[model samples]
Target: MNTGEKDWDKKGWKDVPIAGLITEPGTARRYKTGEWRTHRPVWDPEKCINCLLCWIYCPDSAIQVKDGKVVGIDLEHCKGCGICAHECPSKVRAINMVLESEAEAEDGEKVKEETMREGEEGEKERKEERKGEGGNEK
Candidate 1:
């Protein structure tokens, strides 16, 4: 018996070919592992100090650095590992892990509130202008 075949059978047929084994190396790029994430990282630009710690600690290399500053997080490749948020300096704490559903809801509410506030302010300005015109006409 050939030593190679004998060893393979002795291993309990573990050497059998896997159906979808990655024959081509470096093909992991085609897989988007972000879909597995239950929570997502949200970046608060106002609180970020551009320290680059998040960029350095990200295991998936999802942090986008531009002009020597962290511009944003790349969600496509981010696995929601929370490394960036956890590694962020305590002083800045610019990155936060939020539930995916909560993030969406919060964003919608923010836009609605901003729109209502702007409309109210515009109405106040128009009223002030009308009063000034009445005084001038008299």
Candidate 2:
């Protein structure tokens, strides 16, 4: 048969009669537009008021908190909808919608801060260890 020809009565391909019956599982599906914003929301804990608006408003449930503070975003599943940033109540804006490129720039800044914090903690631990060694002067 030619590719353009229609086989109306091909055994398994034949149309089956349905008495207006619906028998399909409700699967978790995403309404995709095939287009998405490049900007994603990022949280600044220091500026966050712990209002939880960001978490509540996130359509993707991509935001989470810890110790009553917004801590992280699961970027893997985030489609950068910016709904959380739009819902954030902070005047100074703890949550901000940033372009994918701009977010990368900010990620670099955060990495620097994390490295500093780690370095400080390591230094504090070393000081405590030295103090435990009888405040060794040698």
Give one digit per residue, the lDDT tens place, for model 2 in 19-112: 5333433211222221254886677878878888878887765565556666666554467887788888748588787787776676777854
**Could you estimate the TM-score for every candidate?**
0.57, 0.48
Model 2 stretches astray by more than 4 angstroms: 1-37, 90-92, 105-138
Per-residue lDDT of candidate 1, residues 14-126 (tens digit):
55347535455433443445556667898899999998989989997777676788766666457789999999989899999998667657777774465346445543544
Q: Pairing residues by index, what is the TM-score of model 1?
A: 0.57
Compared with the true structure, all predictions reach lDDT values of 0.67, 0.58
TM-score of 2: 0.48
Look at candidate 2 and give me any clashing residue pairs: none
Candidate 1 residue-wise lDDT at 56: 86
